[model samples]
Target chain A: MRAGLDIDMPPSNDPFYAGLGQAVRIGTELLAALIVGGGLGWAADTYLFASGPWGMVVGLIVGVTAGIRNVMRAAQNWSK
Target chain B: MEESPLHPFELHNYIPINLFGLDISINKAVIMMWVVVGLAAFLLVKAGRSRRMVPTKLQSLGELLVEFIRDIILDTMGKGGLKFFPFIATLFVFILFSNLLGLIPGTYTVTSQIIVTAVFALTVYAISIVMGFILHGVKFLGILVPPGTPGWLLPLMIPIELVSQLARPISLAVRLFANMTAGHTILGVLFGLAIGGGLLIGWLPFAFTIAMNGLEVGIAFIQAYIFTVLTCVYIGDAFHLHGADDHAH
Candidate 1:
């Protein structure tokens, strides 16, 4: 049973684990934002704007903005 | 016969049941989930019932798990986070157990399924959003607009913030799903090689399988820990929004 009792400390405090966590978080944040932004843009184009690909194009741009901002904020918090 | 690495993940109904036009079939992954839950519940209950001043091994082990979870809550969300110990602890234990159980040959890996992890992640994400609004009121929207941004940038920043916010649960879901799937798939391939190869050459892949199994065990625990900690961090962000007031000079 002792061998089964491998309770571990929280990895949040360990620099290496923290770094890995941050990387995962940042990657997800950026990709998710882009996907969401582009999705919204595409939706607008299809439903409201009725433009060919402009809506998706605008959405991609918005996604880029969100992704960059997310990365910056994450980096700032990490530095702190 | 060529064995596909993904064959292990294929679902087959053990006991098919339909009620109200819903296919609620008993499958390997579902059975594994119930087994993990039952085992965890039984252990915790037994340990609790037999508590003594001089601790038994089971009692001590239970205490250690509780303490570890408590520290995680405190570290991420502080004293305020203690309210969430039950939730965080359950998430940690369930995922940990599920991962470990999957390490056993012939058992299904539940977390390897994107749907399961997605549900967990999305629930946490939804609850965090609701909690944020409840705790901070309309001011929670202020999380989108960083402090000290010029008026012109507000238009640009808000949409970006919204997109990033939406990304949280997705990342959470994909991380667990990808990790579990990749690890198990590799193990499957290695085992296939070991079995298919003749006894003489089989020893080589067999040796690698042993090492990979050890790594998967460690990964199972690590992934569970990561999921729980990230959930805590999201909850903490909701409660505090630490940088919401930081002004750029």
Candidate 2:
């Protein structure tokens, strides 16, 4: 009810706050995307190489890539 | 697939012994809470004693913490809320210290324990309820009655609001406890896997361990913020200042 105005502002040009906002935004999106990517990758790996380590490999690769993309997006939006 | 690793309910790794016939259980969780209490007390006192026009590093740290809690109170309760600063600041400092203590190796991470979290949550509930009734008397019951409800719906709205209100403490405790416990458990399991799965499978789990550790660090701070913020929200409801809407009218 108080709204967002009550929250404290970070020091101007503070790298810590900038990084934190970037991390929070990016991390949330990345986690969701990873769930989707991991599921897809797991399904593909199951069919291609049944019960293989490649499933984890593929999932990790895609999840990391998507996570990085989210980080970049957050940086663009949150930067002062 | 895998075993539960550890039960959240069971007091595993906890040992009990008799101390002055008190039968104290020396668990990791209890120790961590003591550490949190000690650290908060130490830092705040040290900071208070060392105050200066040009602040020392410890004093500056204390000021920053005070400002953080002050903002939360001001934003939620407004200027009139300043009186509650001691309570709010203490809660924030205790939670933050407890959470950060969990990050230390071999520390019990008391917030990971449900009892500690429950106690803190109940404290907030007690404060808000007591304050509400004391300040507003019978009008405090009106908290459940929103401003514009039809008279017919008063019976229905009141009970639902009461249930929801009661659940606030449970949810607050669960949110902090679950997040901290789950995060720490995940880190534990990942590293356990790295150690158990041989060096061949080491890199993958190791990477996860590091990333999750970093995430846990963020979560440590976040859970503290969230717990404190919700306390402010509850406090706002208690006083029913104009900006606090859910309890309005």
Interface-residue RMSD per candidate? 6.6, 13.9
The estimated TM-scores of all candidates read 0.87, 0.70
True contacts kept of each: 0.47, 0.00
Candidate 1, CAPRI quality class derived from DockQ? acceptable
Task: Give the runs in model 1 whose Cα sits over 4 Å from its true position.
Answer: A1-29, A68-80, B244-249
For candidate 2, give the lDDT of residue A57.
67
TM-score of 2: 0.70
Q: Tens-digit lDDT track for model 2 on A7-77?
A: 33242234574455344434444554455456656876777768676776666566555545544533553
Please name the candidate that would achieve the greatest lDDT relative to the true structure.
1
Candidate 2 docks at the CAPRI level of incorrect
User: Residue pairs in steric clash, candidate 2?
Assistant: none
Q: Give the Cα error of residue B246 in candidate 1, in Å.
A: 11
Worst 10 residues of 1 chain B by lDDT: B240-249
Clashing pairs in 1: none
